[model samples]
Target: MSDFPSIPRLTSSKYFSSLLLLRNIWKGGDLSDDMQFQRVVNQRTYKGELILFAFDLCSVSDALNAVLMLRHVGFEHFLPLTDGAATCEALHALADVKALPTTPCFWSSSSNNHKGWDTWGAGAGCVSGERRRGYCKAEQLWAIRYHVAARLLASRVNLLHMDTDTVIFNDIYTRLKRKPISDYSLILLPESPVNGGLWYAQHTSLDSGAQWVIAEVARRTWEVISLRIRRRSSPPFDQAMLADALVSAMKGERHVAYMCEHPAVALQPPCANASQSRCAYRHYEWVVATLDARNATPLYRACFWRGDAIVTTDEHVIARKQRLVAVH
Candidate 1:
């Protein structure tokens, strides 16, 4: 008999607690025996990797994309953010179809579990105004994501938090090795003038202070950032807050921020109507158009989220499905 504990071990979460990174709000709970994370010492084989991925799958299309990622762009191991049964199934089924050899197990955030009480407090007074509920809920969801991502920082694992909407064409690992993220506290690329789509944080020791900076960002938006959708400018979401926290922590010195522009490092499909005017995720036609245009370019990495857009409501994922069919 194996003398191992029967808990899904989350390395980063444990590291965070060990470092005392949660100076104020870290909550310690009894590990659930029903479904515990599979344990490994660090869960990473190499000492350092340029890009190890973590993806969120909360919807059907997101699952499809996870399959796409595994088939097209190989990932060693990733932190997964799955909010429900469908998302979980899709990730599990990834290896079964398309000649994938094995069903990969992954570590995930505890918040993905269902709740009886109102965990978010009606989106937490984060965003106020008429029609703000939807936006606020989105913010809260992302807040949890950041909260989860912080564990990776605590575990001292370099993580590239990519949305499922993003695609990869070129071999990114080979490229990043040419110019590594060794010096960067965070690797950020502007999705827009005021927004970012992807982030990379290096693995650092408990004393490096990088963990403190990442912790502050998560703490500020622990549950919500409340960036209203109607505003022309960004409304202080987690990305902005993270940038601000890093800036403050770095104290005007080099942020060690490797700011790579999109389309150069990777491809970010413009909204179908982008040539005419800017479009939000609500613009279904624009979303569909971007979906149609995905494979047109030789993209390196694709950041599919549009300014923190909602994943499910957009009707365009249907188009993405059709594209997959045609590929088959």
Candidate 2:
């Protein structure tokens, strides 16, 4: 038996039932009371793919820089999701003044409260001082992300969700198109052990294996954010939980396993290196493959300077990012 907590069946959980209601509500074209979300989605979606990222007031600058970088790289279809009205208004203002083609969507206060959780401040990491508070906000944001992704998947919309800290140098959709979409449910980007900061999801049925994986991740994330269980000393963030969930899903008899052959487009083979024992693993249908770090560089490296299309790491401090942008 796996050491991780057992995932409750989706059909039996009230949380999942709410997501189902949301899925149905969205299907009827009533995405939100304001109808702004539907309008944004309709305008931003490109070649059946939508790029998404979420941010709050504290991270608005980084989000704007990210948007600018993405646009600079010839990407036209992207949406920014924010929980705070202030953040949404700021993004709209900046986009309008800058003549940015993309519009942002705001979630009402009924959906989430941006003020309840403490902000990470300028130079702090997610689990900096007051680990519990920071972790709580991080967990909550991730839960919201998964919830949104689930709704999108239910509506049969393909999406690539990325973090604001990440920088793009090329078109990611063209790279993804190299693979056969029918063969995989999700494609992850490797960050040291693993990362949830960047990933791609294909449109899947409500009951498909991929949806089950997403539900399991969301379930665990919600458990942490809701305080249904006590927080552990070494808390597992969404990325770690996602990695574990993928491993567990792979162990199931119904899930088929495949070896990744192309390191650039898919995950490197398990035996690619003898020193990294964790790198040696098989992928299941739930997570078909991983995008190599060379193409999607994580924070620890300087792959952007070396010509990667996407770099996943960014300075947490606003001043640092601003200085770098000024110099560039």
By lDDT, the best candidate is 2
What candidate 2 gets wrong by more than 4 Å, as runs, is 1-41, 95-102, 108-136, 180-182, 227-235, 253-328
**Per-candidate clashes, comma-separated:** 4, 2
Residue 265 local lDDT, model 1: 14
TM-score of 1: 0.48
Pairs that clash in candidate 2: 270-280, 299-313
Model 2 agreement with the true structure over 18-109: per-residue lDDT tens digits: 22112212211123444655554455565556677877656767777766655444454566665544456766676667765444444433
Report the lDDT tens digits of candidate 1 across residue range 121-162. Answer: 232323212232243244444554665556555656655556
lDDT of 2: 0.45
Which sections of candidate 1 miss by over 4 Å? 1-58, 84-86, 90-136, 179-181, 191-196, 207-209, 223-236, 252-328
TM-score of structure candidate 2 = 0.56
Alpha carbon lDDT at 9, candidate 1:
26
* Total clashes for model 2: 2
The best candidate by TM-score is: 2
